[model samples]
Target: MNTLTINQKNKKNAARIAAFALLIMTIFAGLAFGMIHSNLIVMSDPALTLENLMSQSSKFTIEILAWIVIALMDFVVAVAFFYFFKTTNPQLAKLSAALRILYTLFLSVGIYHLIQIAINLDHTVLSTDIMIHLRSFDVLWSRGLIIFGLHLIVTSLLMFQTYKIPKILSALMLIAGLCYFTVHALYWIAPSIETTTQSIENLLALPMTIGELSFGIWLLVRGSRKPFLNATERFGFNA
Candidate 1:
C-alpha cells in the first residue's frame, strides 16, 4: 500500500477511537452530573449542598472516579481529533487539539478540588471552606468550558474548509461553540444575569448537542471512508 493509504487507515482508526471516547464521555458525564452530583448538590443552598455531600461519601467517591475517567477520555478524544484532522489544516488542527488539551487541564484542576473534598469528607471542617471547594469545581469548569468553545470554533472552521464533513455539521458545531462561549462569558462577565445566561444556553442546547454528537456519530459510521469513497465514486479515482 502507498503512504496515502496507510495514512487514511490511521485516520479511520483515530476516528473510531475518538467516536468511542466521546460515547464513553457522555455516559460518565451523565452519571456524574445528572445522577451522582445532582443528587449531592443543592444549587440554591450551599450549606444544604454540603450536608448532602457529606451524607453520601461513597456515592461522591464514585462521582469522583467518573470524573477522572471523563478527564482521561477527554485527553484521548483530543489526541484522536488531532490525528484525524491534522492533514486538513495542520496549524488550525494543532491549535484545536491544544485548546482542548488545555481545557482538559483546567477540568483536572476542578476535579482536584473534588478530591480534596473527598479526602477530608470525614474530618470536621468549616462549612464555608467546604462550600468554597465545591464552588471551585463549578467556577473552574465553567472557565475551562470557555476554552472548550474556542476549540469547537477552530474545529468547525476546519470542517467548513474541508469536504470530508458536511457543511451542516460545520454550522452546528459553530453554533454550539458560540453557545458555550456566550453562556460561559455571561457567567463570569455579568453574574447578575445568571438566569438569562441559563435561558440562552437552554435555547441553544440542541444545536450544541447535535453538533458534537452528530459528528461523533458520523465518525463512528464512516467519517473517513466516505470522503475517500466519494472520490472513488464521483471522480473515478483509484485508491
Candidate 2:
C-alpha cells in the first residue's frame, strides 16, 4: 500500500482502539462507582459499614477488585485519549494524560487503604481505627476525582477542537468537569458547609453521570465513523 493508504489504515485502527478503551473504562467505572462502591461502602454509619463489609465479604472483595480494574482502565483510557487527540494539540493532550495518571495514582492509594482494611477485618483492630481508614479512603477518592475533573476539562477542550466528536458532547464534558472540580473543592475548603455542599454535589452528579456515560457511548459507537484525514488536513501536523 502507498504511504497515504497506510497512514489512513493506522488512523482507523487507533480510533477503534480509542473507542474500545472508552467502552471498557465506562463499564469498569460504572461497576466501581455505581454498583460496588455505592452499594458496599456505607459512609454514614461506621458500625453498619463494618458489619456490611464483614457480612458481604465476597462482595467487598469484588468491590476492591472493581476499583483496581477502574484504576487500570484509567491508565488505558488516558493513553487512548492522548493518542486520539495529540494531533490537535500534543502538549494539551500530554498534560491531560498526565493528570489522568495522577488521578489513577491517587485512587490506587485509596484502594491500598481498602486492602489494609480488608486485611484487618480478620484482625483485632479497633472499630475507631477501621472507621478512620474508611474515611481516609473516601477522602482520597474525592481528591482523586478533583484531579480527574481537571483531566476532563482538558479533554473537553480537545474534544471541542476536534471535528470527529459532537460539540454537544464537548459542552457536556465541560459542565461535568466544572461540577466535579467545584463540588470537591467545596468539600475540602469548607468542611463546615458539608451539608449544603453535599446537596449541591448530589445535584451536580446528574450532569457528571450523564456526560461521562454519553462520552463513553459516543466513543464506542461513533468514534470511528469519520476519517481522521479531514481533521488532520485542517490542523497542520508535525509529520
Candidate 3:
C-alpha cells in the first residue's frame, strides 16, 4: 500500500508540472494574440467594397487562427490532466483522453480552414455581386462555434467523472454548451439573428477563459491529496 501510494504521488507531481507548463503556454499564446492582431476588425459594410471586404476577411481569418492556438493549448492541458489521473481513475482517464483526441483533431480542422481563408483572402474579395447572393463569414463562425460546443460538452462529461469541480460548475459548462448550440441554431433558422448569435457567443469567452485558468492553477500548484493528510496533502505528487 505504501509503495502504491508513493507511485501515485510521483505521478501526480509530474502531472502538476505538466499542467503548469501548459497553462503558461496558454497564457503566453493569448498575450501574443492580443499583441499581434489586436486591431482586427470584422465588418459587414453596406457598400461591401472589394478592398474593405477582403481586408476585413483576412483579419478575421488570422484572428481565428490565433484563437485556435489557444484552444489547442487548453486541449493539451486537459490531456495532461487525464494522464495524471490514469493510474488512480482509469475510467476518467479514458474519457478525458477521448475528449482530448477529438478536440485536438477538431482544432486542427479549424486551423486548416483558417489557412484556406488566409490564402484566399488576398485573391478573393467580397464583390457586391457575391455579397448579394451569399456570405461566408456567418458560415465560418457558426461552424467553429458548433465544434467548440461539442468540445465543451465532451470536456464537461469527462470532468464529471473526476468530481473535482463543484456540481454547479459542470452545470454552468452545460449551459455554455447550450448557448453554443442555440447560437448556431439561430444563425441557421433566422439569418437575421446574426447579431444575437454573435452577442451570446462572445459573452461566453470571459467565463470559459476564467474556468480553464482556475482549473489549471489548482491542478498545478496543489496537485493531489489524501483524506488523512489534510489540506497539506494536496501537494501529494501526481503524474
TM-score: which candidate is best?
Answer: 1
The candidate 2 region of ten consecutive residues with least summed lDDT is 230-239
Candidates sorted by lDDT, descending order? Answer: 1, 2, 3
List model 2 lDDT by residue over 1-239, tens digit each: 75445544555566677667666767777777788668766777777777777788777788789888878878887887777776667899899999999999989999999888888885366667777887888899899989989998998998887766788999998899999889998888899999999899888878987776687777667666665543665454432
**Could you tell me the C-alpha RMSD of candidate 3 in Å?**
6.1
TM-score of each: 0.91, 0.90, 0.59
lDDT (CA) for every model shown?
0.84, 0.79, 0.55
1-239 per-residue lDDT for model 1 (tens digits): 96566657777888899899988898998899989998897767867877887788889999999999999998999999888777666799899999999999999999999999888876576667777887899999999999999999998997786556788888999988988988898899999999988898888878867888888888888785654222332344433
Query: Which has the higher TM-score value, candidate number 1 or candidate number 2?
Result: 1
User: lDDT value for candidate 3?
Assistant: 0.55
User: Whose TM-score is higher: candidate 1's or candidate 3's?
Assistant: 1
Candidate 2: Cα lDDT at 198: 89
Provide the clash count, candidate 1.
0
